[model samples]
Target: MKYISYYHNPRVSNLLRIVSESPGLTFTEIMRRSGLANGVLSHYLGNMEKRAMIRSKKGRKMTWYFLPHDPIEEDSIIISLRKETSKNILTFLLTKKLATFVEVTRAAKKSPPVVSITLSQLQDLGLIKVTNGFVKKYEVANPDTIMRLSEKIDSTMFEKIKDRFEDTFSYF
Candidate 1:
């Protein structure tokens, strides 16, 4: 007899529940929440995406997965900032208000390609904007949102842990 469907797998159901409750989560965040190994999670995520059960937004630093209709916005920016270099670049821009590419590279203390990819990712998320004039300068599009994210990043750990146990008990 055929095995029960993949959808019946506890891990897959858990993953779906996680995405439904907290859409726009990064792969690592999903893995952490689900307690899945990298290779296994990658395979399951790929299958889910292929079947269109979920959607993912790819970035230089992260890939955010969510239900197809969930809006990403601020959550996407949070994932980007989770990357060390991207966070440094954004932090620098937030302070300077606006700065040219060279200034950002210097401030981030990362090589051109690294800075370039980070900036591109930020631009893609609409978290930062680039203006074309004598030179291209980058600025944080929404300082308040980013400032809020920066403030809340460390504070969310307890909530995440609590949510894990909550989900565990939810099945009872």
Candidate 2:
């Protein structure tokens, strides 16, 4: 509860802001976003995690950070949002409520196979539910939670990722 209050230190506040806005971020990712030196960031992150101000998950190759209260399920959701097709499909379903494979394939604007796999992955993540009938249907499992996670991970970060992919082409 105390972590809910504003920090007197701007650096800590900025660090928290970055993690809160973009959960499931690796250590290097957090450092890059914060523009803090390696030693200082390492110290701050370690201290915060120790103080129960933030949480970290050890991935195979890296450690991802999140707000202290974020559930483990949110890790995959935030990661998936980094991919365009997944986010697009999720957003579409969130709005559409329910749609068949054909409708989703069209809305996702991806190849049928690709859409199929993405839908499967979404279902595996429990973000979307599938209905079996004359036609298979897909819909968001928990609209409120999905929407909140979508909102939690900053869209601006995705734009930054896009810029990197575009590689200076966006400047003009």
- Winner by lDDT: 2
In model 1, what is the error at residue 38, expressed in angstroms?
8.8
Q: Write the per-residue lDDT of candidate 2 for residues 27-134, one digit (tens) a residue.
A: 888889899989999998988888888988785777888898888767888777756889888877766678999999998899999999999899998889999999
Model 1: residues >4 Å from true position, as ranges?
Answer: 1-71, 155-172
Scored by lDDT, model 1 comes in at 0.80
Model 1, span 73-107: residue lDDT tens: 56676666676898888777776778999999998
State TM-scores per candidate.
Answer: 0.53, 0.66
Clashing pairs in 2: none
Deviating ranges (above 4 Å) for candidate 2: 1-10, 37-43, 59-63, 155-172
Give each model's whole-structure lDDT.
Answer: 0.80, 0.81
Q: Over all chains combined, what TM-score does candidate 1 have?
A: 0.53
For TM-score, the strongest prediction is 2
